[model samples]
Target chain A: MEILIYLTQQFINGIQLGAVYALIALGYTMVYGVLRMINFAHGDIFMLGAFISYYGITKFNLPFPILILSTSLLTAVIAILIEKIAYKPLRNAPKISLLITAVGVSLFLEYTLSLNAFFTPNYIGFPRPFEIRSYDIGMFSINNIHLIIFSVTIISLALLYLLIYKSKYGIAMRAASHDLEITRLMGIRTDNIISFTFGIGGALAGIGGLLYSMAYPQINVFMGIMPGIKSFIAAVLGGIGIIHGAVLGGFIIGISEVFVSAFLSSTYRDGVIFIILFIFLLFRPNGIFGKNIEKV
Target chain B: MRFFLELRKLIFLALFIYLIIKLVIFSGLPTDYMIQITLYSFIIVLSSLGLNVIYGFTGQFSLGHAAFYGIGAYTSAYLSKVLEIESYYGLIPVIFLAGIFTAFIAYIIGGPILRLKDDFLAIATLGFGILVRVILDNSDRISEVLGGSRGFVGINKITNLELSFFITVFFIIITKNLIDSRFGLFWRAIKNDELAASSIGVNTFIAKLIAFIYGCFLAGIAGGLYAHLYTFLHPSNFDILKSIDFLIIVIIGGMGSISGTIIAGLFWVFFIEGLRIILPSEILEYRWVLIPIILILIMMIRPYGLMVKKEGY
Candidate 1:
């Protein structure tokens, strides 16, 4: 009975962890779906979101609700600006050049933030805004933070689903992803759609960052690197261009990570994640939902 | 015409050797910081050229060269320390074996990994690099000699200015010859268009695999040399950032240009070390703020690199 409870608790923890990854993975998949490029800087953007929100709450003393809206909106604008300034000119360049530029942008964001006066190079404790409370049901226990994470993830995902399916803008995004040139020929402004896609992706990453801080309650310059890589892996595992696949892949990774740490040595946690990525790349390069396009 | 070109090349080689011998005499005997810097630059040239072959000529993106570098370092360190191999002369053979072992490992993994195209391949290799770091960090469970996070210490410092300089020159000549050969044409073709190359009856995968292995072999040799020179092995030295450093050297040197790689490697090492003298103590940590900007500017202004005009044989 005790073992079952422990297993159930770990499962819940995994779900909570997976929810954050899924949020970040959504941004990754959405951007790749439209641009066919990995925004290597996305994770650092997520870190910026959390840091901004942290400052707002602690320094400016903003409410939690206000913090979420402002952080998401701010991050969306920043993401659009990044696309315009850093990635726009490289659109016609070779794919490798674009990839290198993305890496450059990622490094720029990371090291720039680490410079003194921007943010300290040290880890800062994230003061929890709310009272700590736990609710126990039968043999398992859950926290208020866990509840918030679940509620926010489900609501955001539902809104994303509606935005992608029920809205005209979403339809335009889908069209743009399918064929940018054709969509432009059909009178839809592709540049706007591309920027909008980046905005949405950035907003989702911001939310992911906020939730992550709430759960872990700590922030650092490098907090985004591992999660960003893992979420990208999640994005790949689910099939890079597929939205739902990203979510599935994120949960699978989160759960597997928890299990590995719980059953095996915690030292193997990172190695296992990397190994999964390697195996997937070897056997199924296109991922679970991605279609393989053979070139002539 | 060919005879005159060969004579010119022979003269250039003679001048190069004379210059190196002069430098080695002035700085090599003293073994001071300047000599140490030059020796380290040679090691960088070897590794950067290795990366140049894989990414530049073969057009296969590998973000994991540092992993092979670490593998070579650890392997050599292990052979010298744990196996307790005697004889100073034996160290040369041990270094060769370590490099070969790293190449063999690269060859094995290259088959499956080379199948992925472009960005996918980049991420896969990046993952493999991280995996190597993690394994190196936690390898103490398997053996105590690895020293885990503390790093392996007390290895012999067998790499000196003379030895490293000669070895570096020998490898550069070998690579130069390889790139000038008929097989080099196939690599160039594959880089230009893999599909077209395959249609022309070239085994694209096998050719790429050979380039990858050879490049990794050079990196392994560099790593072995580095381990002995520092007489220490740390897992952190071979992380993703180190891999990026090698990539930057190749890119700055202009891909596929041997002379460019050499020049850029020397410039990069001296420039970075020079920063120590130029930058203030408080801003030392912030010195890297300019690197990414420089990289971006380079990509924007000269995507083909500084020596792009001399790319082909």
Candidate 2:
């Protein structure tokens, strides 16, 4: 009975972690779907989201709804600007050039934020938006923070599904992802669609960042790197361009990480994640839902 | 007679070496610091050259070059300490052995990883890099001398200006000769288009594997030199950021250009170290900000790199 309760508690913890990863993974997948390029800076945007929230709470002391809206909007705008300034000129360049530029932008964000005036290179304790309260359910207990994470993830996922499936912009986004040049020839304004993709992706990462800091309660400039790479792996594991695959990959990664840290030594946690990635890459490079496209 | 036939090229190389020795060693310009920078520049040149082979010539994007470097450093450091080598002469053989060991490890991992393409290959190599770092962080559990996160110290300082200079020049010559060989042709073909190269019966996989192994071997040699030069090894020194630094060197130098690699490697080292002398301690962190901005701007302005023509190789 004790073991069962422990397992359930770990399971809930995994789900909460998975929720944040899924949010980040969605951004990665959507960007890859349209651009076919990994937005390495996406993770830094998530970090920025966390910082913005931290400042919003400590500096402005804004209401919860206003804080969330402003953080998402600010991140979305910054992402669009990044796409315009850094990525737009190199649209026709080689893929490697794009990758390098993304890495550069990522570094730029990290270091610029690390400046003494902005935020020192040290880790800062994240301010919680609300008080935490735990409620007992039979033999197990659950926290309100967990409930917040679950509800937020579900709401975001449902809204994203609606935005992608039911909206005209979503249809255009799908069309853009299918073939950018062809969709452009059909007068779809691919630039806007691409910008929109980055915006939505950045906004999602922002929300994920906010929720992640709430769970972990520590924010640092380099915090985004690990989760970013892990979420990217999640996106790749679920099939690079697939939406649902990212969610599935995120949950699997989150659960496996939790279980490994719980059972094995915590030092092996990162090693095990990469090992899982290697196994998956070896057996199913295209991911579970991905179609094998032979490049001629 | 064959040497006579190459008299002009040989004379130019000797003159270049003489100039470097004169400018750095006997010019009365603070021998210790100058020699240190010169030796470090050679180390960077060798490692960047290795990356140039993989990414520049063979078109393989590896984000794990530093892992091989770290492996070589740790392996050689451990071997030397364990064997209790007293003299620098004894360290020479250990360095080569370290390079060979790194190549062996590369050969093992390259077989499976080389099968992956583009971004998949990048991620796989990155995974390996991170895995190596994690193991290195816990390496104290394996042995007492192989310090974990705290760092590895007390290694012999065997690397000198003469040794580093000679080894660097030798490897540079070897790299140049290799680039002019049949294998170099195979690498170029594979880089241009693997499918086309394979369709022409070029054995693209074997060619890529060779490039990957050789590149890693060079990285190992550089790492060995680095271990003796600094006499200290830290896990953070071999992280993803260091790998990216190599990538930046290769890209800025122009892929597949040996002279460019050498020049850019020296420039990169001097530029960063020069900043130490020029900038105030309070604002030193801004260099990181400036570097990335320059990188992004360079990509925008000259995507093919500074050395390569717009038409590209």
Candidate 3:
């Protein structure tokens, strides 16, 4: 019973952490869906978003909710600008070129943030308003922040679902994902849709960034690189093109990683996650929530 | 017809002599730092050649190639240090042996992961790279000889500019020949269209395996030389960032282009190191900013890289 309870608690923590991954993974899927290119820099963008929001709340003395909102917008604008400058010109270039450019952007952001005196290499401190508390139920217990991460993630995910599916922008986005040419033919401005997708994706990732700062507190400029790599795996696990698949993939990866570390040596944890990804890729390339394999 | 005919055979003969003199007789550059930079650049070129085989020729975007490099460094470094009593094949044979050993490891890991395509494969490969590093960090004996956190140390240095450069050129010629051959053609075709190539009697799987194995062998060879040159080997030596640095090289050079790889390797190594030399201490930590920005600009301008289309590849 105790083991089960322990497992359950670990599982919940996994889900909460997974939510963070899910948010990051969503950006990857969204970009991939529209452009058929992996935005390798997206992870670093999330990293920067976290720091930017940290500053907004701390140095600038902005309210918590407003900080989150502004951070997303700021991240979105930067993403849009980056797309306009770097990716847009290479629209017709070979896939390898774009992949390389993504690396370039990633490196640029990582080092740029590192250079920022305010955003020093030392860990950025966040003022946490949420009370650190815990709750124990039948076979499981979790802290207040975990609860907050869990609830906020659920709410954010729900909101994203509604926005992606219910809004007119959502319909256009889906159409664009399916067939950009036809979508453009049907009087939809795909350029705008693509930028909008980048915007929304960047905004959501910003929230993930802010939430992560609150939970973990330890961050460096290069922090986004690992999580970015991990979330990208989660995105692939969930299916690269599907939005919901990104979410499911995130949770599965997150839970599996924590539990694998809990049971096995932490050394093998990444190896195990990679093994799982490899197996899935070999057997079921579509991923947990993937509908179909989209061609590049 | 006669000139073309004679040219082909002469090219090979000249290449054969070049390899002989380059490997045996040529005493490398005079300056040690020059030798270090040259050697480092050569290794990058060699490893990038390996990467080009799997990634460029095979059309697989593998981000975990550093693991193979690490494997090569550690495997040969350990053998050289421990087996020094027997003196076993000296430094010369260990180069080829290290290549063979790393090939085996690559064969094992690359098989399952090769099935993955695009982004999923990349991240999985990244995970694999990190896994290799973490495992290296934990092992005791590997730490003792190969040096875990402290890194493998106390190896005698045999690498110099001449040795490293000649070896790099030799590897490039070999890689070029492989890419030019039917085997190379098959890899390229698979990259162009996997299913279509498969339908046309190309055993996509086998071709990928062959490219991966050979590519890994080259990487391992480079790692062996790297371990010898630096006389140090640590988990940090072959981290994901190191992999990314190589990625930056190949990308900036122009993927799959041999000359591009060579040019990019030099430009990248010297440029990064050069920036460090020129920049003040206050800005030293942030020097990476310049590289990435330059890379992004280069990609923006010449999407295929500084070179145009790759020759034969």
Candidate 4:
């Protein structure tokens, strides 16, 4: 019974971890669905959001709810601006050009933040705005932060689902994802749809970053890279173009990662994730929900 | 007229080689900073050439070229350092062994991976590169010689200007010859249209596998050269960023152009080093900031890069 409780506790931790990944992976999936580009800098945007929130908490003395709202909005605007500046002009250009630009943007974001004038490369301990409290059920203890993360993730995902499914913008987005040229010919401004996609994606990623920092509490220039890559892996595993699949993929990766570290050496955590990515790419390149289509 | 053109080209080549030799000798010693830059540039050119073949010529879009390079470096480092092979003559075989070993590994991995088209292939390779780095960082369980994250050190400093120059020239010639051969035609055909090439009876899979292995082999050779030149090995040195650096050289130099790779490699190294010398210490860190801007602007202005395509005389 004690072992069962420990395992259950680990499972909840995995879900909490997966919540953050699911949030980030949603952005990746949505953007990929519309643009067919990876947006390699998405992770850096998450890092930027966390840093922005850090300033809000430490410098401005903003409350937790206000910090979350402002950071999401700010990151959303920045991501939309990046899309307009860096990606919009290359819509008709070669795919490789867009990919390279994304990489450039990623490097620009990382190094710029690491600049002495900016966030700097040093790690800053995030000031927790909330009191620490835990509730025990049976033999397992759960933190208030983990509960908050889970609840926030579910609520945000539900809102996103409604926005994507029930709203006119969602229809336009789905149509755009299916065939951009066709949708444009059908009198939809693809440019706006693309921008909207980026906005929502960035907002979700910002929330993810905020929650992640709340859990880990350490902010640095490169904090987003590993999480970003892992979330991308999650997006790929669930299916690049499928929204719900990304969430599923996220939970699976998160649980497996936690279990691997728990049972095996912590060193193998990243290696195992990569191996899982490889396996999925080899056996099911289309992912769990994606359909195999010949891109070439 | 064609014979005269060939003769003229040969004369120019000879003159260029003679000029390089004179410069190397006139520098007084191989240890000079200028010679050091030349040697490092040669290694960059050598490795970028491998990337050019897979990404530029074959259109395989591998993002893990640095992982293969790390493999070669560690292999050579282990053989020479742990096995105590000090003689340059003995090191020659070890270098070839490193290249062969990397090629074999690429050949094995490339079989299943090369099936995926452009973007998927890229992500897979990226993951592979990350996996290599992670394993290298945590390799103490396998052997303490790897030094894990602390880095492996004390390898022989065997690389010099002369050796690097010869190897660079030799690889350039070999690659040029390969591109001019029937194999090059097949690779271009596949790059242009893989389905069409396959329909035309081209063994596209085998052809791609061969290109990947051959490219990785050259990267391995460059890694061996780099390992000896630096006389140290660190997992950090062979990360995804280093892979991106190699790709930048290939892309900025103009993919599929050998002369372009050579020029870009030299230009990139010297430009960074020159920036360090010209800028004050306070502003020197800003060079990195400028580099990404340059990369983005270059892509916007010339998406195909400087040379545009395989240039002609």
> What DockQ does every candidate get?
0.64, 0.65, 0.53, 0.69
Better of 1 and 4 by DockQ: 4
Candidate 2, position B255, lDDT = 80
Candidate 2 residue A203 Cα shift, in angstroms, is 0.4
lDDT of 2: 0.89
Give the Å error, residue A210, model 3.
1.2
Give the number of the best model, judged by DockQ: 4
Tens digits of per-residue lDDT, candidate 4, B1-313, equal 9756864685578458858766767877744566666677888889999998888888888889999999999889888877788777778789899999999999889998999877778888998998999989987668888788889888888887667777777788788778777788788788788889999999999999888999999999999989988888899999888988888888888867888888898888887665555678779778678878878887887876776643221
* Top of the candidates by TM-score: 2
**Global CA lDDT computed for model 1:** 0.86
- The full ranking of all candidates by DockQ, starting with the best, is 4, 2, 1, 3
Candidates in order, TM-scores: namely 0.95, 0.96, 0.89, 0.95
- Candidate 2 lDDT at B300 equals 88
Query: How much lDDT does each candidate structure score?
Result: 0.86, 0.89, 0.79, 0.87
Q: Rank the candidates by lDDT, best first.
A: 2, 4, 1, 3
Candidate 2 CAPRI assessment class: medium
lDDT (10s digit) by residue, model 2, range A1-296 = 99999999989999999888999999999988898888889999999999999999999998877888889899999999999999999999877788889999999999888888889899999989999999999999999999999998899899999999999999999998888899999999999999999999899899899999999999999999989989989988898878999999998889888988888888888899999888888888878678863320
Across B91-185, the per-residue lDDT of candidate 2 in tens digits comes to 88998999999999999999988998776778889899999999999999999899998999999888987667778777887887788789999
TM-score winner between candidates 1 and 2: 2
Q: Which tens-of-lDDT digit does each residue in A178-211 have in candidate 4? A: 9989999999999999999999999999999899
Name the better of 1 and 3 by lDDT: 1
TM-score of 4: 0.95
DockQ of 4: 0.69
